[model samples]
Target chain A: MVPDDDTQTADERWLCAVLQRQGLEVEPARLAELARAQALLARYTEFLRQASPVSVRHLGQPHDA
Target chain B: MMPEADGDTPGLAQAARALRAGSLSSLELTRHCLARIAELDPGLNAFVTLTEERALAAARQADEELRAGHRRGPLHGIPLGLKDVIDLAGVPTSGQSSQLHGHVPMRNAAAVDRLEQAGAVLMGKLTTHEFAFGPPRWGPPGPPARNPWHAAHFAGGSSSGAAVAVASGMLLGALGSDSAGSVRSPAALCGVAGFKPTRARIDLRGSLPLAPSLDCLGPLARSVEDCALLYRALAQPGEDFWRADELPWGEIRGLKIGVVRSFLDERSGTSAPTRTAIGDAIATFEALGCEVRDVSLPAPWEWNAAGMVILLGEAFAYHEHWLRSRPQHYGAGLRDALLLGATLSAADYCRAQEHRQALSSNLDALLEDVDLLLCPIQASAAPPLDQLTTWGFLEKPSYGIAFNLSDNPALSVCCGFGPQGLPLALQLVGRRNDEITPLRAGHAYEQACEWHRRRPPL
Candidate 1:
């Protein structure tokens, strides 16, 4: 879970900036929500970073349509 | 001999036998199903649309064809429902979403086409989770289907109604699309048979896309034999169809079975009743002369996360346009869930894809010496509706998604009942395209035990 502190707020703002750059609308009604989701998804990427160590990467997989 | 349809509801295979023997006409079977739906659907909430007129017309045509010595195979004259996501030419495939309320397809989905070709009587569209992504958020279109075993409990989603309809005898068979445990979860919760064949075994054109890459259309019925019959009817043109009767049932003794014990370890907080049921099943298999061996599997969390990323990314890609144009049209649950995918980077999806391939290969390596892998589909019985949390699906680790990622054929068959009398199911997985092994094992186990014979108290 993302911590509740000053850093978290700053992180949310930074995440919001990246999302806006990614072409998202980031409307006021959904701004805070989308920012939190961005943080969570970033964590998913982080999971991949950790998983990469234990997981095999690209074992000659034939691309599935 | 004419089957005396006293009060008991015969399964699909038996009903088809009666229809072929001239003891039961399609019209009679259709009427019985319609009556049951009328009497029970008010409490069960199993359908989005009921095609009474068309079903009767189709049944009449089926009877005419059968009387003229024309048989379309096992599903002929059998009344069945399709998960609302399945397209049926002129019928609206609402998918329990208010957004698609007016959407109707011009052609039947490939799976639907196959069922029709086999002379199936299309009863109607059954309820599904909104967009096949979230649990029921009821309103506008219809109410979510409830478990017939205990009305207060949830019949699983996103294929909720398909399981409920079959459990309640409203339909002999159903077509449910499983992207991540949707079909199997519902079948286990409702105490019926659900088969998720190899990913490419059935085509999905015209079906509403949830996660295109992972989507599989499968059958949910009462017996493994019945599920196999439905699969035979819907099997892809050249895909290997596993016919249950053709396999040597006793060969199960020679095959090796692997049990994934870590999947239900205490750290996962699996329920006792479910664990006990699977334990009994493992012992039963051993007693029946099969060699059981313990197998180590990847952490459930890893497999669960792997499935979710692929699911979320693909789902967002499919619904991105609508989500942007008419966000309010989506139910609250799906709207938020789709938003998470909006932030997924291209690298993230690619990474998940890499993991997907890796995981499949790892599981394949483990199963190289084993004939089948057996595990529990659900860790507990169906909980009450109020007991479900909004984000529960995201938080929990799934037992069914690993095979989905591997593209292996997995089946959910009833193993036993919990103390509350709700059903628990055993998941049988087989090598890709080698679905016959699991079906034969399921048939043998089902024949030996009385689990599949039991039905919901409703």
Candidate 2:
């Protein structure tokens, strides 16, 4: 394929391409927007990975997780 | 016969008295509302559908019922609008999405059924953002609703039109749904009272859902009492229903109000106008003999982040089919958000729920010390609608969402005006299912000030 000119990372681009293969249509401009969202999710993932101070209170709380 | 223009719309309570005293006919009030909609809705665009015939018929039935002494209650013959997310029989419950534009329901949602039986006249459907995630213009099915207070500014969302209609007197009250501040945000911005009862206490059947875990239906009206009336009428059994009119407004004397100061502290994203307004409100609470104290909880952003994950996980499950099949039909803003929702794994979703549990328990513990928690409704007054970006909804932490995550009750009432004359308001949050105390505090505050009396200069 032609060299992609937008700023989406390869993984995000692959994710969009996979979604497109799954029949979800997205505009070219939306690829950049999707990348921004992925960046946010990255932050969220990092945030969630770290144990919160009150996380010990979560022991035996019967959470579905 | 009364003149077409009565200048200002009366509150639901005052109108009920006029109807009972034989001074006003339901048909007259209905016609007055229709006239107002016709004259003013081009600028406000609060209504997506005008059920003129249905409204008039309902009004006539109400008049007949009153004449026959079969009165319902305070909401009798009151003209109201439903946010388009609510399913009204035979009307297309668009949820402001193009995909749902042609999808009309054969039956009313349970909330709609109860409100109709209470003698509420259905004026029509108001606009929402695309599928209840909006500030009105995300390639949705209808026009963006304008703020009645300022024509060029935002009216908030997704209950943007619900708040506008009430503020502009196009309708006295409207039902607004909240997942993350949909009801209260617009209400605060539009200078009206927005109420979010505990989500679990009310029936959610037949209404569209953005996040089933956090979705709630509520009422926005001119005053706290009006909100309480709708709240009692809509609540299921054991939901702690009380008459706002009979609230002990005198209870303001000794109640300990917890002021969430961190939210208003430096760099908290609260604008100067909103800061001044909250400062004034705290002082007013002190003057009213309420003991105000600084209270802290985990940073609100943590709760906000947890809520977003839950909402996306749930909303994605509902919209996955559409996201795969008819993605083009959604607005770019909602489309991107939903697609991003695709990135959250089952692990992410489950962990988010775990986080939600923690946040809920934390909020519950935080409230054990205060009768009610005072918080800012918006970082600032309603900005111009043009400033909203496609991904704007996801960018910020909503103060209202924290309560939703905790399943607590919240009410947004106008605290005061900013220098630009736009409305600034606060959120009064109470313990889970403790709807009475917050309504009481809201009523007490609403009475001690003239904020609720001031309407948008439509």
Best by lDDT: 1
Tens-digit lDDT track of model 2 for A1-48: 113557657866676765666566557756767777767665665565
Q: What is the alpha-carbon lDDT for the whole of candidate 2? A: 0.82
Clashing pairs in 2: none
The candidate that wins on TM-score is 2
- Model 2 misplaced regions, further than 4 Å: A1-8, A17-23, A52-65, B1-6, B138-140, B243-249
Best model per DockQ: 2
Worst 10 residues of 2 chain B by lDDT: B239-248
Q: For model 1, report DockQ.
A: 0.29
lDDT of 1 by residue, B36-107 (tens): 899999999999999999999999999999999998887899899999999998999998888996998899
Please list the residue runs of candidate 1 whose C-alpha ends up more than 4 Å from where it truly belongs after superposition. A1-43, A53-65, B1-6, B237-250
- In Å, residue B243's CA in model 1 sits off its true spot by 6.4
Poorest 10 consecutive residues by lDDT, candidate 1 chain B: B239-248
Candidate 2 per-residue C-alpha lDDT over B305-350 given as tens digits, one digit per residue, 9 for 90 to 100: 7777788878888999988777778877787777777777776777
How much lDDT does each candidate structure score?
Answer: 0.84, 0.82
